[model samples]
Target: MVERRPAGLRHSIKKQMAAVFSLLMMGTILLCWFINNFFLGEYYISKKQNAMFATYQILNMAATNGTLSTDSFDIEFQKNCGKYNINYILLDAESKTLKTSTPDYSTYSQRLLNNLFGENAEHQKLLETGEKYEIQIAEDDRTATEFLEMWGVLDNGNLFLFRSPLESIRESVKLANRFLGEVGIASAIISAVIVYLISRQITKPIEELTGISERMIHLDFDAKYTGKSRTEIAQLGQNINELSYTLEQTISELKSANNELQRDIERKNKIDEMRKEFLANVSHELKTPIALIQGYAEGLKEGISDDEESRNFYCEVIMDEAAKMNNMVKKLMTLNELEFGNEKVEMERFDIVALIRNYLQASELLCRQKEIEVIMEAKKPVYVWADEFMIEEVFGNYFSNALNHIAGKRVIDVKLNRHDNLVRVSVFNTGEQIPEDSLPHIWDKFYKVDKARTRAYGGSGVGLSIVKAVMEALNQKYGAVNYDNGVEFWFELESAGEKVDDEKGMETEESQNG
Candidate 1:
């Protein structure tokens, strides 16, 4: 089954990062707005109070020095009043104006007198009190405006009053908070978009890695992480690439091992089947010879063949049966070695034409005794590559089989024909055509088409089987073909061509007359 990601998690990292960054920015802006709303007014008032106290100290010092009306004192006092946005009025012990920064001195003096006498106290909130001074937030009854006011008695028994307007400061604080809110909202939106874009850049590699892992799940190891950065993400990509390579190699090795194991299993099964078939064929083939040998020996022991000729025939029959059994056993051993790969083939360059002629020459007497005509068509050397001894065995089996089955025209034809890079040696004999169905089984051990005829001629039916084994060992082709006149058996070997040096100086004569 395919794996799937949770619905909520898809593409969430970018969004989450953008959200978190925007929240932090907006939170900082909100905190600033909150401070502006709750504390800015008090801070402004405190700074104004400090300015007023400094001015008062300067004025008190001047009055003590009797320089309150001097030009330098007037200049300094006027500058302080303007800088602190304060309006001040000073009165003598007789209630006459001594120095004033505002033209409305009478009005300020009345207000100060009212404050000193505790009149209009219900309209004032006291902020601080001292032996010589008191600070309060008071409202102007006519204008409904508030002021941060300081009134005190001078050392000379004179009165001084200082006041600054509080309305503008409150408006500034509110305006600042509103402006912060506006900027914070705009910054949050723009920062969110920028953060989202940056987050996509960061998450792109992670998404690619996820895709690679998905492909790996399906056993496809082709996808790879190609990022070249030195970040942790890049390191992870390199690790994943290595993991993919390792897994691909491991899986390939496993598949190879599995295939080898399967081949071994099939080979084992084939060997077991061949073994069973071999045992059955061997038992069947040996039975008749063993029974004959036993029966004849028993007759001799019982005096059933008392005559000298009869006794000699009995002994000869036993020896012949024993020899056949011995020959059959040797052939069986040779076949076994070839089939089991115990016998190694020695490949060498040799003239196939000369080999055939020499074999026919060796069997010329047998051919004459059978009164069969033998024919060979090649007159030149046909050099080929093969295991010389094994090829000879193959040729010998074909020739013998053809001779044993020779009939009708009583002629044997041996031909060496070349096709492409191979030489085909065919042995044909005039005889009854091998049955079509039995042709396929002719190469099986101990499979005879006519059992009675095979027994009459002492044919063991293992020659073709040996031929099959030898040809297979040499990795060549061998087969039989049926014609109207007879059957032709053929085998092929790799051609060495006439260019090879004739080390044996062997030459083939024209067609041999039998």
Candidate 2:
């Protein structure tokens, strides 16, 4: 059963990063709001007080320079007074107004005169006092409005009063804080969304790395991190890719080693079994010849045969058995060399048709004795790539086996056919068909279809096995096919084409004959 992970924002790094960033932004906005609420009002009030002192200085300078009533001074002074929303009255020593910024000059003049005379002193609260001026928070009895007021004596003894409305400054500070709160909330929300999207982009590579790790757990190394980022995450992904490649190569080599180990063990066991079977077959085959030779020798020793011909007969029997044993031993050695890869196969281009004809010519007398008709279907030279000696041995085995088995029509058929780049040579003799069940095992060492018939023909049951080994060494194909009246043994070799010079062909044939 496969396990599944629960899906939720709680387990997501993207969500966590978004939440943390949004919280920081919100915290910053709230900090700004709190600072504005607590300090913005006092800051505005301090700025207004500074503006009033600046007005006082400029008016006192103009009065001393005798330019207090000039149109230039009046224009500059009025501009400053309007910018700060200040109401002012300027009076000479005669208590006559020199310049007044308010439409109702009488009201501001009376206020300034009352301040100098200390009549309205109870209606004021002094904030800062100087040698020539006093700054205060005062209220107007007529309009019930509060002001930051400066009342003082200027140079040349001109009396001046500078006051700005405090209500407007307090209202502006409140409006600014309200505006900041609203904008801060909106900005924090927008900033949070943007940070969340950016965090997701940042985490995309991390997610890819996570998937790669999960696949690695299952030993799949095909998934790779392909991100082109130069961040630490990209470096980590590159490291993981390297680790995955290393592990894949190491594990592949281990698996190959393991498979090779298994094959070695199996081959060793097979070789041991073949050794045991070989010994048993060798012993079995040698038992009869040894028994026959022993019996004939003992008879001759006991003088059982009085006539010289009888003694010669006994000796002949013994010699024949001994010769059979020698032949069997030679075949066994040949089969052993082929099976153990000790036989070196020297490959060369050879005229196979000429070799076949030469072998048939040599065996013509034997064919006549057996009264078997030999038919050759190829007169033209068929050149093929093979070990000439090995191919000759293979052909000899098939011809001998066919000769021994020939019956019915008593005919031997040899053919050479070319297909693509390969030349197939087939030898067919008119005889009993090989049993279907025995066909597959005929190439096995010591396997005979008819044991008695094979024994009569001095067969060691190793000829076809040698054929199998040689064909396998050449990395070619060889097989036997059963027909209705006969079996055909066939083998194929790589073709070397038929376009050789006549002189070269003759030389090759002469070499085989030699």
Candidate 3:
């Protein structure tokens, strides 16, 4: 279990994520405000300038060309002023209003005109002179109302004013700011939540790995990372998990080795006694084969009895004994490697059922010769995790043992039992049941089940021992069960695909019930 961090810790990932999101959102809001305050005004000014220039061209064309009469000109002037939101008064040299586009006399533009002229003859004369004048009406301390007025003398010497208000842009900017505020608040809230959640996801594995490391520092190998993801952090966690397992296994092996070493050092007498016993057994085992070979070779060289068939027979015996010795030595070497933990078990997924069938097929000649019926009970493949080579050796040993020992009915039955995440294969032959006293000693090296049998029928007696070593190396259970009819040798391997079929079976059962 991981301890809770202090509540006052400020460098939490959630806070960091929130801070970064806040900065990004705030920067966006600031940029919106900057564009509204600075560039928006220029944008509005440019639009106003274009509208004024377009209106001037229309009015000047109508007045200069013969395209419009006085009445038609007044209609065109009202249309342009209404479309562009302009209010104006067209005046003659005496300041008489020929046409006015303003519906109300109290408009800001009209009020400005009143304030600028105020019945002053000189001011009226100056404004009517074919010159342009622009003014601003103060609305508040932060804002003002602007109007552009152009005074131009028509070709007939009549004067007119074109006034367009620029205050509509201020309200637009205000509306934009209000919208920006609402959106910015919502964005900040959402981004903060999203970033915080993402940060937790990224940091959760790191925290788990840290806790696992702390436990590992104290030599606890069982604190493994159990989280699953496709991210690099998850991959790192998986690697650390494998490392912990490897460390645990390595340490366990080292401790066992050290204990064995200490025992060996303490019991020098027992070591000497075991060494003597081992050498005696090896010498005794080698003596018969070597003596037979030596005698046969001498007989062949001396041409004893001077018969070709007899010489060939002697040579065959020597060669057969030499082969037996070779097989025994090979088994011994394999046993030594397994017992010393020098052999590396390469694990992979394979169909154990298929392997059993292939081995049975390979031994068909022997089965035929022995008049034995090999029966494999399974049809579908049973996928299991194990060293394929080691499993092959295991199956070969069991099969060979069964063939040599078959008696009644001469039947060999191979059964595969698959359970939760594991598969156990058993080889049973119809033969004499193994003796009760020999059940526990059957896996010992060179301990023959049939003591009367020699190298021709009985093996070096290391097959079962090798099976035990390999099974133990894989950390699984394996043993033999002596039945009334025959002996059943069985061993289990870890499986990778057990749950799939089970799930499918469950679904089928559920559907049937439904």
Candidate 4:
């Protein structure tokens, strides 16, 4: 009996699909974050550095050359800084504002500058020296504010510095922030879409394989999940399909073998039942003859047969019934011993020619009563290793059957031949051909083709079965070959040779064990 397992709801396809989707989504988000915060951030920082470098160049030229008085130099410096949107400022050594190009100055600028550079009173002391020029390039409002807070300036009036416009730097920072925000959103959306598509591509084959496996577990052998193309998923799909096909084939073969075994078991059970019925029939047959013999003997003892002729008749009836009972017992014992593995066959090399001739001579008298002739055809003496008693009984049964069944010319013929390490012997009788439908079952125990004829001839119906068992026990081959006119039962045995004894003994032991 096969036990069924309960279905598990937790391990379904939806759970697997959700797990894959979550992983893919998380991965894409992380990748997009990396590109936005690190790669693009570094890129914008590099552009800012270039702009700052350009600003530094313009401020340095204006501070070193003292070109504040010339409109052409001022215009050139402003134009260079404007090209990259760089802002600059120049100051005298006392930190007094010497030049400026920014317009968005608020009142807080003066305070911030006062805190970073000194007051305008300090400007006079810087002009006293020959080195009266100074330049300052600030990063942005954030950076400058940080510097201003760290470095406090006083009206001590000795030293000062220049500062770039905070408003322009602030504007640049805002623009860079806005650009990065847009890029981050775009990258996240694109990455998510790509990742989802990619995960779908990778997981499709896995999903198909899972489906196929589920169907297979339910005994659906024909499910197929072929891949769409030559990708890893496709290859995975192909491999799974191949595995499914192989598993299906193996399962089919196992089922076929199991079915055949079941049929064979059933057939053997029926045969066992029939064998019991046959035993009962044989017992009744034996008892009938035995009762007759006992009754006749009782009559003789009571002097019921007073005349000599009557006494002789009673005696003949008793002997005849006794003989019949004896024959039945002998056949029964033969079959029983063979079936029970109690009969041991002692095989030896013997001239088959002499055996057949002896059998024919012995049966000649019985055949004469029926106007039947027994004939032998042999090209030469044939030697075979067989049990003398068993082979003789086999021939006797066949000859007897033929004697009863033969019609018209009423002839039984025995032929012998040898071919390469094997000998063939056939017994042919002129009789009605065995029905084709019954040909295959002729060797089954107690199987009668014509029940009435079998009873008339005193046939026990174990003759062909005995022949089959004998041949099998000896490890020889035998079969019935039917023709249009008559049927021939033939058997083949190993040729008598140096190794025949050893092989025959091995076969005998095997059959006994079996």
Superposed model 1: Cα runs more than 4 Å off: 1-247, 263-271, 499-514
Range of the 10 consecutive residues with the lowest summed lDDT in candidate 2: 505-514
> What does the lDDT come to for candidate 3?
0.73
lDDT of 2 at 433: 91
User: Tens-digit lDDT track for model 1 on 1-514?
Assistant: 7676653455478889998999899889989888888998889998988998899899899989999878998998898899889999999888889888789898999998998899999999999898999999999988999999999998888999998989987988888888889988998999999999999999999988988988997789999999989999999999999999999999999999999999999899989988999899989999999999999999999999568999999999999999889988988999989988989989899888788899999999999999999987566777889999988999999998888899998999887665567777788899999999999999998989999988877888899999999999988999998888888898989988664223232223222222
| lDDT of each residue in 90-172, candidate 2, tens digit only | 88888899888787988888888888888877778999999999999998998988889999899799888888888898889
Q: Which runs of model 2 end up more than 4 angstroms from their true locations?
A: 1-223, 229-240, 252-267, 499-514
What digit string (tens of lDDT, one per residue) describes model 3 on residues 1-514?
Answer: 9785553445866678778888889898889888887788667766665676677667767767855457777787678778877776656566566556766533534444454464322232122222443332222222344554454556665555666655676777778877888888888888888888888887888878888887887789888888878888888989999999999999999999999998888678655765675677678789888999999898878778587788889988988888988988888788778876789999999887778878888889978987899876466656789999999999899988888888888888877665666667788888788888989999887788676663667377778989999999999998888777888888888876655344211222112110
Q: Residue 238 in candidate 2 has what lDDT? A: 97
- Candidate 3: where is the Cα deviation over 4 Å? 1-278, 499-514
Go through the candidates in order and give each one's C-alpha lDDT: 0.88, 0.87, 0.73, 0.63
lDDT of 2: 0.87
TM-score of 3: 0.46
- lDDT score of model 4? 0.63
Best by lDDT: 1
